[model samples]
Target: MNIDISKEDFELAPGESVLIHTNEFIKVPNTLSACIYERYSVKSLGLMISPAHYMNPGYKGNIGLLAVNHSTVPIKLIPGIKICQLALFELTSEPLRPYEKQGGKYMDAKSASISKLHLDAEIQEFLKSKGVQKASDDMAKELGEYLMGHIRASAKRLADILRAEEESQKNG
Candidate 1:
């Protein structure tokens, strides 16, 4: 895909989505363009891949695939399964400037990168003006402590509930 999608060996619940990163990094030739589609196997399992638009010729990166779980239950992706395809189409003529040549934002990506929407030219100037400043040591510590307190409380509550449920079953 033009952008990066990253996921692996995940149990996707119904209405949940996953990002699929290709194991192999491929380099498309300048003379061809491609589109990514899921094979029939995925469809049979009630999974549908979001169709990626034309993989621009001369792209050099791991293909990203976004899949949605539509089945009633959770589904785990199995490895070594041919889940999708890159259907390459020959161009009438070679492109004067290809993906890598023009320094596309996604060129030579090594991992599943989320949408680089912030990097677009339109909003960059505004974003720069409101750019993030480094947090002070005390400020950082205070924020971290606050968040951690909530995390610990939530975790303890869940643990207590589970323990009670187990005890109830044993007593019954």
Candidate 2:
């Protein structure tokens, strides 16, 4: 996934998204992890890197970035430009099992990759146990409604507490 952005800058229209691979390959040791951040200058251009920016220890690959253009106009992604910055941190102790040993879907990926969440063994096991062959739209709708109800209730409770505090202050 070597994107020669230098030869032809990738163009992104407003609200468009693209997955781009880093020009550099990265290797994380068993005792270290990396955090990815959009370069401050790149962010100023109204392009946002995906929020999934944490690289686990023992990851070896070119980092993939899911970028979205939030500006009103189109933006150009120049290849070889430092669009993102990575900060590495050493862990207190080496993990018993590192990313390479975990059988993760994206380990040693060389290019931009779509999510392989559906292929996770744990999730598959859960689904099989529950007799769920696949995800359903109805299930998603029900979950959304359930979460929204809780959010509404929490908001109402906060509003009531704030109103009570305001009244108490006025009386005091």
Candidate 3:
């Protein structure tokens, strides 16, 4: 769906992130799933969407995008820009139970949702079996730290490359 990001245009300071809703609401069939991706052009602008790209079958909702600014300066997200795309794939076979039938927490979600993984019965059971009730929280913190560190390092490397290019041009 084509959407105008004009009114929704947002600025993200370096290292900052925000959740943005897609202009389109999607409905997936039980026999199909989708992978969400950021448009390649956006990468050149120093913005990235989280890599959690998988969309479950039987989902009906507006996609929520986690936008991050990795550049040293703030990045302005303009409306009307093709921020993301969806690649749909056919499943080998339909599941006996689809997400909607199973009471998926994110069913019909209109906006980006925080993780509801903790509410999954299997996850709860696994945590109970492992005696690690706080695992989810701990894992989230660790993952955030790891990702931020990498982003910082990548930004530094890009800056270094730019500086080198400038110097080479001056001498050439």
Candidate 4:
């Protein structure tokens, strides 16, 4: 890990997310993988939501995260919040090639964005095609609530699956 970064350099206001740059952005050597972990210490207990927690090998440039404080209390983000760590490992071969050649969804994410997921027109169209229409002005409020509830349940199911996998990996 021939890289350099510090917390003071990534200073943040009470509610802000800044791109913490690194000294060198290694290319993963085409034969290694990196695992990023968000180093947060709090009693989250499924109540607080952290930022994204994975960065694959072959990713370029300084890694940035779209972190936010989900708790009611204001949390100051010091530059060295230990936001994340990139664990490097030698891979048997290049992992699935570069993102561009793989044509994955995040192939075009040149930088970190704080945008909502599924807010793209392409996704909206897909949802509409699946019969999720915006109700009339009179029904808009109620319809929004209903949709939110459904989405929350779906997200809960996804979280459950992820938790189960993590637990199994720890035990087995």
Candidate 5:
């Protein structure tokens, strides 16, 4: 279904997430500019927002961004909270392909999420063997590193996509 953000806001429990507004309105006179950063700019402030946050041309809704908690500790998110700030720009012209139609994996994500990176069966087996109840310190540390690796790889892939998109817009 299609999503839109009104005046209502939402609060997120430790691991909870919801779609929020980028506080942008793209109209004929003004274009919305969204910066896909490595972290949330409001609550986490200094923390990084991760992997491929974007806004499409002609988009006019509560911008959906996946804001998965990356901390080991619990965190709270409230509605209308400036999870991020959208910078507005005046594009010389409307882009050829809108953001939603760019055909990326995260076209309409509305909340925080886990890595979509592929993991091997062997690693899954190893992690499973560690078990929720029996994970050792070393295992925990290793898993954290593994997660980081996935994020890094995903970030690189996103960068490639953004670069290509930028080029496409420029060429057209």
Candidate 6:
């Protein structure tokens, strides 16, 4: 789900990973492409931005990030925070098919837009051939819920153990 950070800050729980986006709209020139990187300052806060980092030439959208909170505590993420860095590359030549031309679903997509993998040209073709059209969301959502449950449970257990240790130390 896309978090609208415009109104208020978002709190990311420990062991949680979320898709975030830079609120800024960007336009990449046909001659250039871009890559996204986690800023060191943000990384130091135990938030890691995973890859799929290549922003193709002609991509016009807000930058998206897969941010994971690795620390034991929750992290408050504010809007307009400098969470990631963008590095542009001047391509020797533009792709035969640019991001928009090649059916990249993310072109001009909003920040944290749900995956458009289903909209990929090849995938659409295969679905059409099979006369089958199904959202991959059901399985993906179930898996995400299951994994988040497991993570929350594990974090709770760890916190309990730490609290017990602290109590024991104080009593001793």
- By lDDT, who's the top model here? 2
Instruction: Give the TM-score comparing model 4 with the true structure, all chains together.
Output: 0.42
Poorest lDDT segment (10 consecutive residues) of candidate 6: 132-141
Please rank every candidate by lDDT, starting with the best.
Answer: 2, 3, 6, 1, 4, 5
RMSD, candidate 6, Å: 4.7
lDDT of 6 by residue, 1-172 (tens): 5557777679999888888777778899989988888888888889898754788889998777788999999998887677777898998986898778976768786666556666666877887789866546565467567888998899899999999999999999
lDDT of each: 0.74, 0.82, 0.80, 0.51, 0.51, 0.80
Return the TM-score for each candidate structure: 0.66, 0.70, 0.66, 0.42, 0.36, 0.72
Q: Per-residue lDDT of 86-145 in model 4, one digit per residue for the tens? A: 678786777666644544344335444333335456766776899976334345446655
lDDT of 3: 0.80
Stretches of candidate 3 exceeding 4 Å from the true structure: 1-9, 122-172
Q: Local error of candidate 5 at 49, Å? A: 4.1
- Candidate 1 vs candidate 6: the lDDT winner is 6
C-alpha-based local distance difference test score of model 1:
0.74
Off by over 4 Å in 5: 1-33, 36-52, 96-172
Candidate 5 lDDT at 169 equals 100
Q: What is the lDDT of residue 154 in candidate 4?
A: 100
lDDT string for model 3 (50-169, tens) is 765777889888888889998899987776678787899999999888889988877888877556676688888887899866556457557666887998899999999999999999
Error of 1 at 99 (Å): 0.3
Question: Number of clashes in every candidate structure?
Answer: 0, 1, 3, 2, 9, 0
TM-score head-to-head 2 vs 3, winner: 2
lDDT of 1 by residue, 1-172 (tens): 2332234455778867766677778788999998878888888898888766467889988766677898999987776677787889999999999988876877777755555554556556665578744334455457656886898799889989999999999998
